[model samples]
Target: MERPFSVFHYGGTTSYDAHGGRRSRDIPAGEAGSGLGGGGLHRLHHHTDHDGRPAPHREAHSESGHGWERLVFSNALQAVSIVSVVQCGVGLSNADVVPKYGFGPIIKFLKVLVVQQILWAVSLSLCKIAILLLYSKIFATRAMVMAARIMAGFTAVWTVITVLIAFFICRPLSDNWLLDLKNRNCGNQPAADGTMGVLNMITDIAVLVMPISYLWKLRLETYKKVALIVTFSLGVL
Candidate 1:
């Protein structure tokens, strides 16, 4: 009897044989069944048996240890992003709250705004770190893994610095929300924001380009490489 095979539709279509061996159309024949392609999510695609039912195999255990790590980071990013959006909707809009009310509402808005800034920095950092972790898992090259670790560390340090700046930008921290308070010494708000914004863009671009080199080296067709690159580049948007 002929062995069973299963076809799965991930970013690209890939077929698996009876022994849980992957054979992607885009990947060369020699490279097929070497290891799983794509990220951790690809591991979810299982091979089928002669009856077309899902069958478990050793490939399912490939990089299984990092599953929880990815889940935790992804979940944390979603939770933080959701809370940031909710907080912004409730009390952080300067245009909506400032014109309709007096200093009382303005102060409240500023307070929420401060918290929102910290959350924004945190959420952004979490997103970058999550991407780096995914890179480390999927690429798994020594250089790629080292770069991912360095970038993750940099992202964490950047988040801490951003939060610290948000908290201590104004001395006697109350002055952050206390608009009319006397003897307030605040740093250059616009300049600081501009600098951070530029730095954030730099980091974003760095992360976006990190995988391109490794991806191009893969034994894939040009169109497939472009498609893969475009898919990864969507993070910029």
Candidate 2:
């Protein structure tokens, strides 16, 4: 008597038979191939119950409970950053006053500039923190969550240090924007500025690259991986 047989059709054309209670054997292409016109085995294996499809580990929480915090923080950062930029532009526009009023007016402008810098640092730090929180919300991997926490800590520390550097760059604190430049002693402003710029870029790059490794490790096609990389790359710009 013939062994019990079953015909399983998948991927458009290919069918499989179970013989002697063993694993199903895929019919070779061109033999019973009449389905999707491709390798029946390929589609069967990849699309078995949509196994190959990317599944979200968690629901995206961008505007729900904790997600609402991310939105608020991001909006506040944008507002503060815009104000700082406008303040800087106004300060620079006073170029004529600098020559006409001597160091006094320029010193006053520097005071305002210093305040703007503080605002910028605060906004930037908050922006990074918000991004990390969003990452933690979307990706459920322990590595991703831990990385976000670490980066948030780094951002907080950087904010504190940069603000302190800005405030104490000039001695007596009041001498920062005062006209008593001849007798006042100020720290290396240029060096501090350069250092902060480098640190800012470094942190930004760190945030941009943080999720790349996790994304690359995912079981996704190369095109999908590249798309994800591009999405994160927007943060840099």
**Top candidate when judged by TM-score against the true structure:** 1
Residue lDDT tens for model 2, 100-149: 55555455456666766777787678778888876664443477789889
Looking at model 1, the pairs that clash are none
lDDT of 1 by residue, 181-216 (tens): 566688887888888888888889999999887667
TM-score of each: 0.63, 0.59
The Cα local distance difference test for each model comes to: 0.68, 0.61
- For candidate 2, the 10 contiguous residues with the lowest summed lDDT are 40-49
Q: Pick the candidate with the highest lDDT.
A: 1
**Residue 125 lDDT (model 2):** 82
